[model samples]
Target: MLSRRRFLKTAAASTLCLTAAPAILRAKNLNSRLQIAGIGCDGKGWSDIQEMSTHGMTDLVAFCDVDLARTEMVHSLSPSAPIFQDYRELFAKQGDKIDAVTISTPDHMHAIIAIEAMQRGKHVYCQKPLTHSVREARQLSNLATKSGVITRMGNQIHSHAVYRNAAKALQTGMIGKVKQVQSWCQSTGHGKSGFIDRPKTNAPIPKSLNWDLWLGVAPERPYGLQDVYHPFGWRDWQDFGNGALGDFGCHILDPVYTGLKITAAPISISAKSTGMNDEVWPAQMTVHYVLPGNDFTTDGNLEITWMDGGLRPSLQGTHIPPGTALPSSGSLVIGETGTLVIPHYAPHVLYPSPDAKANVEKFVAEPSLNHYHGWVDGCLSGQQPSDGFDYGGRLTEAVLLGNIAVRFPGQKLEWNADQLKVTNLEAANKWLSRDYRSGWKLPETV
Candidate 1:
């Protein structure tokens, strides 16, 4: 699997060539069309440009958003793109008319606008808890594998079909090994709980809001009044969101790390929450993680956990059926031979006992995927979409290292993930990453 000229001659003899690699991975033109662009266009960025322009092969043109009145319904639907308010001036004045970009903003300007639009090779499509720490989700998943572009992380329910039938029923064993998973989400984000500090009144910024480009790399605050933090309640704040398990742990643990490929690096992590303060996040939480397992998990170890405000998980002994409940934000798994569940985006049941339930119904009747046209057909086939960004940036840096174990609640933390570090504290390796707004930095390569 290392062939890309032996991963650039073994990353040019180690130090991973200092990082931001891709100087060229561009491709597009597979019959012309592409040219898209649209970063933070409006709520969920105009619902991800109305699902990436319903796959008409793109051509949305351009449209950034630092809130020109939230670009009024994506300028009444594309209306000749060109809306800019700074996505670094939409790539310093339309970087060659863009070929890909989606970004949905606000998670602290997702790794500096996807590391400056994948170092101009373009093709991004970020969203979800893609970044906003955990070292910008491990440097935008190693700069989307050193900028080969064609990335995707808007965990749009990882292409719903209830998570491709719970990632094809736990990678085909139809839920057999999977040591223990459990998830949740029912509250926080409207159920309330985040903002606990910093908003000692500043207000007055709104005149169509641009409050310092919505506090770009954070660290500068002021506007706090429409239920604290900017428009979408800034997820609930903590330098602009990462709460609610980094706002829905990469969408309910993306089928427990894409049906258990898990990509290692979680020797531990812990939490218990409902306490944090220095500026929000913690109404109810739980976390946990563990990982380090493989062949679909069992004795090798795997755990997981999570939870959110409504805080659930122990349905007494399991079976269910008597009115079957437990969902608000789902994912259960369990498995030795059966459990499953799912619920969040719906349908995935399977119990096998209490008078039979099963009903997974084949990856939810197949033919579904359109998560923003699967990143516009993976940018015209350079491929890499099922939540790409090197597998959704290692499930968003292990769900933002469970928000640094909810800032030391029970204090487990360990991780290492090939030196992305945090090896047992040093103040949990200073929450992985921060410090951007002193005239903003990023760009150590991309």
Candidate 2:
């Protein structure tokens, strides 16, 4: 992490830290392209590789996925690229050939893959909610700082023009001094919490799927049908996924963090859930945070609340426009002047309402950016990404903390950021991390 003085020095000099890290790998000549590898080459990984490999500076050289069916599709794209079912084998064999990697694996597997890749001097573009646990988030951040590797967390919308304008508007004071903010997403996974039971009878594992490789660092569990916990439904599981708030908090609250310049963890955080069991996420969750605000907020204090599972902020109760209806998934910014309602990645709406819906000239005037290419270029040029691990780790830490608070619903947990502990509740601190199953223990140092 760059110190405050270094940041100021760079800003005043109108320059960036373009010097390559000591561990960075670059061609002897400037004309060579980057050799890239895709881990979990399906779903988001498929799209990430599609976009990134299209860049003039990238070469898709390797693909890794637990499912042969998924790799078959990616294989057609880069037919010459080697394929592997396990990332460890891929790293061991192709370390010399790969320049950087894009990791889109499940939450539980992200840290180990990223750390191993980074330790070998490879840059990384990892998917969101950076890790499965808060402790891992902190560890990854420290490793990134120590290794000085180019890295980015996959919150793609962070680079979009809409979100960029929202952040700019706050910095520009278009919305006067934001005192409070509310963000939310639909609760498909959370709604399933009422029925907190896993399938007692294990379905036959698919021949096409490598269940053991897919499990990775996650504790051993019987594989069920894809509908239960394989391809998509794992988001509802306690062991494999990071619930709704864990999944979407990083993406939804990104603009708020950027706009308000939120640099520290929340002073305190707590949550209340309708009812949650060990099997699934809660049906409903309301997480509250008292953040240490920056220049964009009032008096160095701000209150931000997150809701899901058929919950929405009350615009009528707040300073927002009267009789306003909430969107299925979006954020509401409450300021002294008016409110700014952003519906996910779409355009933001201002309160007291703009006269012409088309008249957003004061808002967005720039073009959207390609997030995948930005990371690729950052690796090649030594330019730090906008949503790099330094920022993403802090955001992930807060989001994971909300998950911890959910375990002890209706109880406040005071955070000691510097110490990375729950100062008030010693018992609650245990939820920050878990003991890795035998072969899954994380190395103490990178």
Candidate 3:
């Protein structure tokens, strides 16, 4: 088993070789023409395929999904590609032929499929939040390192020029001694409590869907339309998803964490909800994170507030200084000198008066590249990806901690990052890991 230190050293060495390859030699190598496969071929997965194709070197070779209809739909986009309903079979049969696998599946299945691919010597790109549980995130990161595979988390916004600029600006002290961060996702979907469970209904599974495979690492459960497709709402269920915080927190809070170089777990976490139930949604929910004060010595302390599902910070009380449209879903950084507001989705923007639109004087704007291709390019050339497993796992761990706070709403939870456990809440600590179904054990060290 590779120790964490050894794994990082190997990854760094591999990154050097990948990034130093000459353009002429790179173009001539057929092995460099990345043959890729897609799992969960609808929504983000479908779009990722299109984005990857634009890189000119990617060959869309296979598509997999529990829903046959989804696989067929994706096959239309790449008619020559083979299709499979089970990802395990797809990986086993075609692992060697493909250079990488892109997992844009629901949050729960991420670790199972990604770990399998990495063990088979295939690079992987799994969507964020990287895993359903904190333990899964750690395992995935460790496995990627052990297998010597290049990996990326699908927080695509991280590749945006503005996000990189935001980090650079903060690093250069453009934000001037940052102190507090406010991140939010104004979602109406998971209002109060997240997804309500379907009553014990024996609804027949869809003919086109393979129910067992969809459940993957989650506990075995009978299928329901509510559980599977249409409205595509599995995100609200605790069994297969992480609700709103898990969905948007990875993308929204990532920039702030990255710019700040926050690696340790929060010293404390607390949450409140307007709507509470046996299930996960709090209607509107707010989570507060008190990071260790030592990370930013100049700033006495830093706090990150996560708001979602109709819960949000009041613009009136915020320091935006009026006349500015509050960002619907993004982050607000309160620095010693001024504040910066960034948008949630694509085309992340910087804010506060003239700086919001003034061509971002210190930054460069360039056409966006596909995050999947960036990983492939990095792998083949031995360059480090911006959101590889180590960084991705950390980001996922941070966001998932917010989910843990929701699970133990109103409790002040203390975390021990080195031990990877919640120190103050014994009940909450139980959720740090999960039991995989039969035949689905994560490697002990990887």
Which numbered prediction scores highest in TM-score against the true structure? 2
lDDT of each: 0.74, 0.79, 0.71
- Evaluated at residue 103, the lDDT of candidate 2 is 95
Can you give the lDDT of residue 242 in candidate 3? 78
lDDT of model 1 at position 130: 85
Structure candidate 1, residue pairs in collision: none
Quote the positional error of residue 403 for candidate 1 in Å.
14
| Cα RMSDs, all models | 19.1, 10.1, 9.6
Poorly placed runs, candidate 3 (over 4 Å): 1-30, 188-195, 199-203, 226-231, 293-297, 315-319, 346-367
lDDT for each residue of candidate 1 in 228-274, tens digit (9 for 90 to 100) = 66667777777877867877888888877887778776788898776
Instruction: Give per-residue CA lDDT, model 2, range 1-446, as digits (tens).
Output: 22346334322322111122224233221237878999988888898888887899888889887765676667777887877667776776687788889999888888878877777778889999899999999988888877767899999999998888878777767667888899988874544333367777778886556787778778888886556777767778888788888788998999889988899899999999887888788877899999887778877679999998778888764556567677788888877666788788887777733432323456545578999999988888877888999999999999999989988888899999999999989999888887776556565543
In model 1, state the lDDT of residue 94.
73
Candidate 2 Cα errors over 4 Å, as ranges: 1-31, 191-195, 352-364
Kindly provide the TM-score of model 3 when superposed on the true structure, using C-alpha atoms: 0.85
